[model samples]
Target: MYFTSALVSRSLIKNAGIIFSKQPVPKNLYATRLFGTSLQKQAEAFIPKQRIKSLLPTNNSFRQAVTRFCSKAAEPAKGQKAVGWWLVGCSGMVFVAVVLGGVTRLTESGLSMSHWKLLGEKPPTTKEDWIREFEYYKQFPEFKLKNAEMTLEEFKFIFWMEYGHRMWGRCIGAFYAIPAAYFWSRGYFNKSMKIKVGIFGTLIGLQGLMGWYMVKSGLEDRFQDPNDVPRVSQYRLAAHLSFALGLYILFLMSAFDHLMPTKQHAIEITQKALKLRKYAHISKGMIFLTAISGAFVAGLDAGLVYNSFPMFADRWIPSDLWAISPAIKNVTENPTTVQFNHRILGTSTLALISGMWMLSRKCKLPPRAHTAATAVVIMGWMQVVLGISTLLTYVPTHLAASHQSGSLILLSMAVWLTHELKYLKKLPK
Candidate 1:
């Protein structure tokens, strides 16, 4: 019932190194194959040679196709391409989810959604449902202490903002998990890669849990304003934002690891990468701190505090930077201090990345590595400009969203530069 080298010409199966690309499978098990007699029979001399040739494994056409298919599947390099694209999808989803989260914050819509559920559900569909949802929101501190004047129609706007964010997060999970399982089943991953996917999936689940935790902070009576305005805790907000940014970096790093893996050092390249590594790492830390500072500014509505650029209230050092007690509390717990720190951190990151780029120009480096270093400089500058614009413009929703997206872009460029520089062995000249 199967073709064998014993019966067929040996030259066909053994042709070059391409034909029998993988270990031989039982002849009948090949998914892509010409149908043959379910049961083999003795050769019949009376059978027409032309007709018999069609069923023979030695047929040139059959061998060519099987050669191509098996050649691709058996080669590990080709499989890596498939897995790389799958990771690109995951990374793309993470970027979108981060942007959506920023928009939700800009809209002041995070506290509108009072419940979190595993199953996907639609918003209130009827009068009774709308009223019930609105009443449920009324019971929360956000409505009682701050938004008591919010009409049902106004509530709908913020409701959709938060709802869209949650829905996008759900889509990200679907995009990642479905393709991950498919790629894994197709044997695209090695053992180490499988472990990485597991860890990534686990972190995604934790991000969801953190989302709920952040929302819960604003729903309680802990933090309040003199005007009785209710908002999420800055600490929790910073934690949520930090985790999201970190997750984005993970997706990016893993994607690049598979897609554009570091080529082996050809002819013992320059030592510039060694020095670049130190700068790249410091740049990454600056990006992370800047993002955290942005989170604190958002939490305290501190962007509204100083609408002027290059200075807060026209003062380099605002008088109220430590208005809160215990001194240390003013850094994270005070609006004026938080805004000041964000400005310093953002400006410092811009200066640090610019220095890294300048250092890159003085050494021989891979073209891609140089390009990535350049991107860090350009994006870092863009982030600062956007931050200043977001502040001067009073944190308009669209501008603020752009500012947040800019942070992630800067972060990605920094990570790429860092990864590229890590491969260099010696110090730059």
Candidate 2:
């Protein structure tokens, strides 16, 4: 009986130990999930988690991480700084070159060099080459009649102007190429950007070819103005100027693309902006047409021919409007007609752009974009003023050159505004 009772007690002790091992104490259970419970308690303590109203860009590290993630979602990436800066520099050089080219054209220095040399043949490195080049110029009608008594030194002066212009163009090409190559080699280029830059380079090269083409026109004999010192064809000059401005805008757009400081997705905003851009295209077309007319005004020396205000030679429309046979001929040769069209185009463009500016006020836009649009409006008005002054003053070399500069500024502003309004931020993954 005692042995049986001791065995029963041992069995009971063993069962008690097994039960305690399976079920931990209350305090021990709380400790096991203490961190998770604390987190839940904190979350539940707030009446509304979102309504805590933390300051923007919260001080807490966790909040900062959340905010950064949200920001990243909105704006994928900003434009690469290094690439943007490089493009800006290149664009600036191109702008200066355009201004200089305008000066060269206004001063009639474009035709001073009657020869085209790709390489090898130098620009009068020796006295012999100088004399030879001078002799070549003497054969042209300009030397025979207009500049008959021009000395070798005087010839060299004009020669240098043309030489400098061509050299500047070469410099532009080099500037574009070296940096472009470096960036591309370093994996900076994407497929679309590569195509864009390639197109720009090709256009620049073609512009050089067109420059020679323009100069060649003046060097060759003319059927219409047989006795005149032939100047470049107005049509060709317009084409050249158009291409140059195109190149400038392209570079500007690319620069803006690279310098975009934010990668914010505004797809809906961008679609609306694109709709506005279509209207902007009309403004672009008007601006371009006005510019071409200005070129025609320059080409025929039209501004110099008609210096009067509100009238051309004692009449609103010059008596020689249809002087050329078949009437179509008057458009190019008749200085009065070309100047008349230029005035019409210029005034029309000014009116159209002003109206567009007013219409732009109806749309809501980002603050930076609004500023750009306003700038475009102001620049347009300034350009109109410059145009009037240029015409009233008979396109003086200085003012005419300044007017050209103003036009470029106006174009740039218009482009920037267009870009800003149409801007679509890249999305983050």
Per-prediction TM-score to the true structure, in the order listed: 0.80, 0.77
Model 2 misplacement above 4 A: 1-59, 62-79, 119-121, 125-129, 223-226, 261-277, 423-429
lDDT of 1 by residue, 389-419 (tens): 8889899988998998888888888888877
Q: Tens digits of per-residue lDDT for model 2 on 1-429?
A: 434543453343234334534432223222232222222232223223453342122344443333232222223233356677877777787788778777888877787787787641367888998988888888876666567788999888788877888888888888899988988887777788889879989998888898889888887756235467567888888888888888888888778877754344354453445455566777777877787778888888888776777677688878778887888978777788898888888778788777777766766566676677678778888887887788788788889988888888877777777667554543343
lDDT of 2: 0.71
lDDT score, candidate 1: 0.77
Clashes, model 1: 0
CA displacement after TM-score superposition, residue 92 of candidate 1 (Å): 1.6
Clashing residue pairs in candidate 2 are 75-263
The TM-score that candidate 1 achieves is 0.80
